[model samples]
Target: MKLKLILSILFVATCFVALGQEKSPEKGLIKISIMYPYSEGKTFNMEYYETKHMPMVASFLGANLVKYTIEKGLSSGIPNQPLPYLAIGTFYVKSLSEYQAAVAPQRDAFRADFKNYTDVTPVILVSEVVK
Candidate 1:
């Protein structure tokens, strides 16, 4: 009756308000990474870095740390070759200009922190979608 109709309307209104509140991520290049050859031996150091370092860097660059993915197997020679762990993070921006500007300071921080974990330098490569 009347009560049922009023409840339905309230539910629909509430759903709309909830959906509207979600923030849309800006269109830009998200920092995707493939941090590989993680030391299987230095389990403790690696774990610490993953937990502590990544969030600090992500916050500095005004970016969202999307996920940490463990890469495995080779496409060309999956039978023999094994892929390494690849951790992914993202920087949402209106354009590359903003993205680049944000990371410059944080880059040095990453380098310094990363030296403790592995000898190889971490490199940042950029990619733009073409369609």
Candidate 2:
């Protein structure tokens, strides 16, 4: 019937409008992602990173850090393909300035600890999370 068709059109239009709305990023929250790309002859000690390095970093971050996560790369999408990254570490903080202030004084300590873990240079990204 015409009523059924009209309702269907209205439902579709409502869905479109809902989907078009953009999600706003969380206020005063910053995400720092540290990624280590995979390469030939590169070495990564996951145990050292997870057990020692991250904990040290967390201690420095202190109350500013909300939470953190570590991810170990296994393989690429294609079967038998090499992984794109050796590892990834992400942490969330309440304030970017606070996080920076916390790490600035200890930058050298972090660099020195790197030699104890991996030779791969890490890529860092600061991002805002939207949901």
Candidate 3:
């Protein structure tokens, strides 16, 4: 009985250790998040953003971009509260420098296209994915 209990404890401890282990981070990868904050009188054209804006941005990133995701905020955790953001767009690139090199020339084009989609200024964040 003691031996069985010891074995069970060992198995459980091993399982816990495995479960608690953090996932290895993706090295040398950069994540760029473009967030549009929610506010009164702000204008966001979801259709234009999804169809036109994002695709244009992706084209600029080209081979450097691994993938991209777009999210639309519905509502806050509180009841009857306003949504925190109108939309969010995130793209993962192999490196920050590569992404910058790719987008530098097209920065003006990007800014020019923004008026077609949204009135609110976007918040940009660049971060490393460290698990």
Candidate 4:
């Protein structure tokens, strides 16, 4: 009876360990970050980005967009170095194809809105989520 109880406890513990493990994100997961570099005398209106641009992006992209986050870059680690970017915006989506399809139609609208927010040309990075 003691042997049986020990085996049962071991089985339950193994199950719990497996359940607690972090599963990889779904296979098609993609993340895109648009980074606006900082320059002296340049302007980045964080208020416009949060209030106008993001809402427009959400409305334009609709279901293809899983979620998004915006970050304002404050300073570089070095005391005197200028910040590398004024702002960064990240978009999480299910797949590249889905994102492309959704944005293609609204491309013009997105471009037009950029002039309203910042003058810095954004550097874009697209990455697949692994692990």
- Reference-based lDDT, each prediction: 0.52, 0.91, 0.90, 0.87
* Candidate 4, poorest ten consecutive residues by summed lDDT: 20-29
Minimal lDDT window, size 10, model 2: 20-29
| Model 4 TM-score (2 dp) | 0.78
Candidate 1 lDDT, 1-131, residue by residue in tens: 99999999999999999988865443333445534443444222456455676656556545333333333323333555533433333333345566567667677777777666555434445664231
lDDT of 2 by residue, 6-116 (tens): 999999999999887845545447999999999989999999999999989989888889889999999887888889999999988988999999999999999899999
The best candidate in terms of lDDT = 2
Off by over 4 Å in 1: 1-29, 37-44, 63-77, 84-94, 129-131
lDDT of 4 by residue, 1-131 (tens): 99999999999999999988959654457988999999999999999999999888777666778888999999997999989999999888887787888788888988899999998899999998775
Model 4 misplacement above 4 A: 1-20, 24-28
Residues 47-131 of candidate 3 have per-residue lDDT tens digits of: 9999999998898887889889999999898999998889999998988998999989999999899899899898999999875
**Global Cα lDDT for candidate 1:** 0.52
RMSD of 4: 3.4
Q: In candidate 3, residue 26 scores what lDDT? A: 60
